[model samples]
Structure formats: structure tokens, C-alpha cells
Target: MSKTLIVYGSTTGNTESVSDDIAKILEKNGHSVEIQDAADISVDGLADQFDTVLLGCSTWGEDEIELQDDFIPLFENLEQAALKGKKVAVFGCGDSSYEYFCGAVDVIEEKAGELGAVLLGESLKIDGDPEPEEVSAWTESIMTKM
Candidate 1:
């Protein structure tokens, strides 16, 4: 079984809910999983213990892409996470009406690529409320890569 770590930042609980759903699916698949709230995590060597790392954050802003408040610090210090050649996946929740829907996911994917992490698949961008089946499917799709 793969050891997985899910780090997420949420304001209104939407992103947190998605994280829970993903964890449930991964656990049911027999993967050892741990969920960390971005506000409480230390980015230093964050991915060292996990075979797979999933990042989830919410995008905020009217004309700019602002990562969820608590995630900004972690995002800025991602290099300390030691993601080089590690398996990483990105996901986020956002409003589709905005110009940059789930923009945080795109930002993270780019950063992860720069860090040389092996991205599993396309990042899951949830618009508005998250659906259980959708989260499950996305989580399952990445299971193959792990």
C-alpha cells in the first residue's frame, strides 16, 4: 500500500470536505493516508514520509489568483517539502464564474513541475460544491500511478 499525505487549506470548509472525501476513497483502496491542515503543517520535509502527496487549496480573489489564506505560506515554501522526483497531485475548489476557476491547482501544478515531482494526472478542479462521485473518480484515477 502506498503511503499518502493530503494537505489542504480551506476557509468555508468546502476544500476540507473534498479532502475528507479523497481520504476516504484512498483509505478504502488500502492506502495509508494522513490529512494535514495547511495552517498546521510544517513544509520542511513534508513529503518525505509519504509515497504520494495530494495538495488541495481554494482560490480567492476577483481579478487575481490568491491561494487560500493559510496555504500561501506553505505554497511559498514548497521547496522545503523536498518534492523532487516525488509523486504529487493537485486539486482545489473554486467558483467557475471567476476568470481563474480553481486557479490554485494550476499554480501548484506548475510549481510541482518545477520542483521535479512526478505528477500523476491532470489536477482535479472542482467548481462550486464538490460531488462525492467526482472526487472518488478523480482519486481513483490517480491510484494507478501510485
Candidate 2:
């Protein structure tokens, strides 16, 4: 089974809740899963620990990466050499009314690619709140890839 890390940055717990649900689904499917607060995870040591790295964040301040004030620094310090060949996924919560729906997920996707990580599945975007069907589909897609 592939090991997956679900890291999330949530200001009001929305993204955290979604990340937890995704982790539960992954674990239920017999995959080893680690759920961490994005701020608490070490970008340096993450490369060797898991086969898949999933990131979740909510949009803040006009499509800018949320809670990125901290996570971005960690991500900036990350070298492409550290993440080469790793599989990755991104999921996030955002307001669809915003011009850039799921902008946070997009940021994670772009950065993950720059680090040479392969996307495990399509990025999932939840509007305001994540629906059960959406989460299930996203979880299933990632499991299928694994």
C-alpha cells in the first residue's frame, strides 16, 4: 500500500475538516495515512517518509495562497531534488463566488509540479463547504491512482 500524507492549513477549520475526511477515506481503503497541520510538517524530511503528499488550504485575500505566510516559507526552502519523483495531490475549500475558485489548490498544484512531484489525481475544489459526494469522488480517484 502506498503511504500518503495529508497536510492542511485552515484558518476556520473548514480545510482541516475536509483533509480529515480525505485521510479517513484513504485509511479505510487500506492505505497508510498521516494527517498533519501544514505548519507542523517538515518539508525537509517529508520526501523520504511517504509515497504521496497531499496538501489542503483555503483561499485567503483574493486568490492568494492561504496561511502561506508560514507554509510558503517552508515550501520555498524545499528543493526540487528533495521531491523529485514523488506523487502529490491537492484539495481545498474556497468561495466559488471568487474569481479564482479553488485558487489555493491551484497554488499547491503549481508548486508541487515545480518540485518535480507527480500529481496523483485531479485537484478537488470545494465551494464554501465540501459535499460528501465531492469528497468521496476525490478520495476514490486518489485511491485508484495508488
lDDT of 2 by residue, 67-144 (tens): 344456555665732567888888888888878777768877887888788888789988987798889888898888
RMSD (Å) of each candidate, 1 decimal = 0.6, 2.0
Cα error, residue 85 of model 1, in Å, equals 1.0
Candidate 1: Cα lDDT at 133:
86
The lowest-lDDT stretch of 10 consecutive residues in candidate 2 is: 63-72
Question: Once superposed on the true structure, which residue ranges of model 2 sit more than 4 Å away at CA?
Answer: 63-70
lDDT of 1 by residue, 1-146 (tens): 79999999999999999999999988998999999999999999999988999999999998999999999999999999999989999999999999988899999999999999999999999988998888989998999899
Please list the residue runs of candidate 1 whose C-alpha ends up more than 4 Å from where it truly belongs after superposition: none
Listed in order, each prediction's TM-score against the native is 0.98, 0.89
